[model samples]
Target: MITEAEKWTKEFYQKRGWSEYGPFIRIGFLMEEAGELARAVRAYEIGRDRPDETKRTAGELKRELVEEMGDVMGNLIMLAGMYDVSLEDMMEAHRKKLTERFKGETS
Candidate 1:
């Protein structure tokens, strides 16, 4: 699943000349997207804190959360590419580390 997305992410950036933007730019994007995701998550589940954003319906807020999540993931994939890191490898290592750390937690 992540492998396919990584390939697509590389191509997407290359085709748009965004690959030249470098790792720092991608890092900046990741930070911005993460913040957006935080706000989206809060808005969707806890109702809006700001007056202007209050009009959005639950469905709209949920969609916003989903979109922000996609943005965050896409940025992460691109940043991984910048560092020559494969998401598949990242996934495997993550799985190994967590599995070892919490040996009997899965239910």
Candidate 2:
């Protein structure tokens, strides 16, 4: 089944006429998405580390994290769409690379 991420990504490209762009543009978009994730994580940390921090509860932190994660996922889906990539395929490729890096005997 196509996910919301897929739908958003398709709309994003369709609205722009699916113009071809350099790979670097996608890389930049990924970086921006990563930054958003980092910001969310930092917010969670700050919300958790409070001497007298009773303002934000854990639930609030979780909500913020989820929102940030959604942003990350959305951006990733958009980037993958831009490059005609499948997330499942990308994950499999990533797993293979990681396995080779960590499990391969050859130095």
Candidate 3:
């Protein structure tokens, strides 16, 4: 399910006046954000180490991961708004599909 925070994030993007971009540009930007989120995930999983500098602690890395994740989700929500897509309905359908696919799995 899309959380209350996701709803607020969509509104935040709207308030920032971000709907001027075309879908192609927005989708590309969303993909870029997703890439950053992936990097954050990698950092969280393995230490963000550099031979020339000190490695970040797991907690610090987690904070970075969370921020990157929010960026990705914000873009997604923005795209949904631009396309007139209802994330709530989409998530519900997705949940139903997953429930059928994995009957015994706990959501």
Candidate 4:
């Protein structure tokens, strides 16, 4: 199934004329998004700029985190598109490497 993110990414790049931005530029953008996400994480951990909820539920906190994470992932997906890198394949390869590295470990 083509995800909403994939569709949005395609249309976004097309609308912004970002298809001309090669892998190098996209990688820089990806780094920028990662930094933004990291800053968001730090703020959340320090209870800064949180919602005015009496009891900050896990869902509320997670929503904020996920929004930042989504930006990071969006940039990563854009970069992958620029380079013809399949995230699914990369994830599978990463999983295999991790499994091999932690063969004797149990959570």
Model 2, position 42, has a per-residue lDDT of 81
Candidate whose TM-score is highest: 1
lDDT of 1 by residue, 54-83 (tens): 478888988999999988888888888766
State every prediction's TM-score relative to the real structure: 0.84, 0.65, 0.76, 0.73
Error of 2 at 64 (Å): 0.7
lDDT of 3 by residue, 70-99 (tens): 888778877877766667976888989988
List runs of model 1 lying over 4 Å from the truth: 104-107
The candidate that wins on lDDT is 1
Ranking by lDDT: 1, 3, 4, 2
User: For each predicted model, how many residue pairs clash, with residues at least 3 apart or on different chains?
Assistant: 0, 0, 0, 0
TM-score of 1: 0.84
Candidate 3 TM-score, true structure as reference: 0.76
Output the better candidate (2/4) by lDDT: 4
Compose the digit string of candidate 2's lDDT tens values, residues 1-107: 45666887668766886425555775776688788778768868764455775667678877878987876676677677666777777888998998888995765
lDDT of 4 at 17: 90
Question: What RMSD does each model have against the real structure?
Answer: 2.1, 4.9, 3.1, 4.1
Error of 2 at 47 (Å): 3.0
* Model 1 error, position 95 (Å): 0.8
